[model samples]
Structure formats: C-alpha cells, structure tokens
Target: MANRFLAGYHAAFNQYGIWLSVPGVDVTASGPAANFLLRPDFKCEQIIISGRVAVAAGFNVDVMLPITVPTKRPYVQFGVAQSGVGQYPHDLSMIGTTAQIECIGGCLFRSDRLTFSNSNASGFTFYYDYLVFQRGIN
Candidate 1:
C-alpha cells in the first residue's frame, strides 16, 4: 500500500546517494565574507565543489578548502581572485574547485577577505554545489 511505497522511496534515496547546493554565500562592501560548513555526518572520500564568484571592483576574492584533522589543520588553496572589471561591464565570473580527502567527515569552505582595500565595489557572491560520493558507490 501507500506505506510500502513510502518505505521503498526512502530506502532508494538513502542508498543511492546525496547532493547539496548552497547558493549566494555573499560577501559585501562593509565586510565579513561568507563561510560554508558541511555536515559532520558527511562520510566520503572525495568531494567536488563547483561555483561562481561574482564581485565588484576594488576587492579580490579567493577560495580555500580547509580539511579538519586531529592536529595541525591546513588549507588547500584553489586560486587567487582575479581583477574585476568596473561596475558598468558586469564582471561576473565562474569558478570550479575540487578537493580530495581521506575517508573523513565534515569540511569547510572559506573565502578570503578583501585583497584590496581601495575599491568601493558593491559585493561578492559565491554560488556553490557540493557532491559527496560513498566509498564504493562511485
């Protein structure tokens, strides 16, 4: 009946895999950039994050993948932010970053603060999609 169908759907969803998308991790003119933290229950060997970085002039943006461990936490640098065009041109750009980690859970994404303090740019937005793959599921 209906109960059986619901059970089957839930089983398939959990067994197959899971994906999450976080939009508009924004950084603004005032200050304070956005930070993203994945769930602690996340257990996977590899993770792929693809996103777009958009910002106004006078600011530089960079992406970093920070892996958590028992001692001595380190970060893997993706790339430095590129020079943005003026407001009129609309210099929105796309960035794709990936990280490979040991069989662990919980990860974080951090955007670098203002590289240049002169420009009065409006803001920045990082749209990211994260995918987690089980060890043998592919």
Candidate 2:
C-alpha cells in the first residue's frame, strides 16, 4: 500500500509538480500566495495540505488540487496553523472532505475564499503548517 501510494505521489509530482503534504510543516506562502501547480490532465484520488500562510481578510488564498482523479471522488485532509506575531497560535484540522471536481480549462482549482473578519480584524493572517494526502484504490 505504501509503495502504491508513493507511486501515485511520484506520478503527480512528475506530471503536475504537486508535492505531498508534510503534516505540521509550513511551506512558503508569500508572493501571490502559495500555489500547487496541479495540471488538470493528471488524475489524483486525494490531496492533503498542512501549512501556514498569512492572507488578510477578504484576500484570497488559492491552492490547486485534482477535484476528481478520473471518476473517483477526491478526499482532502488538512492541518492548519493560524498564527501571527504576539498572537496565540491555533490549530485546525479537516480530516476528510470529498470534493466535487469540476473543470473549466484543464486544471482543478480551489481557493480559500472565506473572509475571517473577526480573525483578521487586527490584520492577522491565517497560517497553515501541515499537509498530507492519499490516493484511493484504483
């Protein structure tokens, strides 16, 4: 199972440049926000992301992933680290969420479009620091 999982992951990386999520680790989410260059051509069963980034309220943070790997519903998992200087850090996790995959051009795109007015009232940014994913049985 592990080898098969890695095979799928490697395939995704080679084809789409998407990286497997390392739980509790934050990747650089600066300039233009962070991007997972997932080409819609490749199919994936699941995607997991765990990381930290700061995006002002009303501002959008985008991450790309395969909504559906062929005909299977993609599962997503995330561990988010919300933090700021002098502010308490909080953790949030979404174990699994089935995505409704749709395509426009040739890519699967998803953006964190929620505006946390109360949280960002002080210009606090949302930081994610952990990510992990797995592909479904084909």
In order, candidate lDDTs are 0.27, 0.33
Give the TM-score of each candidate. 0.19, 0.32
In terms of lDDT, the poorest run of 10 residues in model 2 is 100-109
Best-fitting candidate, scored by TM-score? 2
| Model 1 poorest ten-residue lDDT run | 1-10
lDDT of 1 by residue, 35-134 (tens): 2122212444333232334433444444342322223222222322333332222223423424321211112433322121214334432222223222
How far off is residue 87 in model 1, in Å? 24
1-138: candidate 2 lDDT, tens digit per residue = 111112222332332123322333222221111232232233454344333455554455555442223333333443333334322222533223253222111112233222212233444344543233455332
Candidate 1: clashing pairs of residues:
58-119
Give me the runs in candidate 1 sitting further than 4 Å from their true place. 1-45, 59-75, 81-138
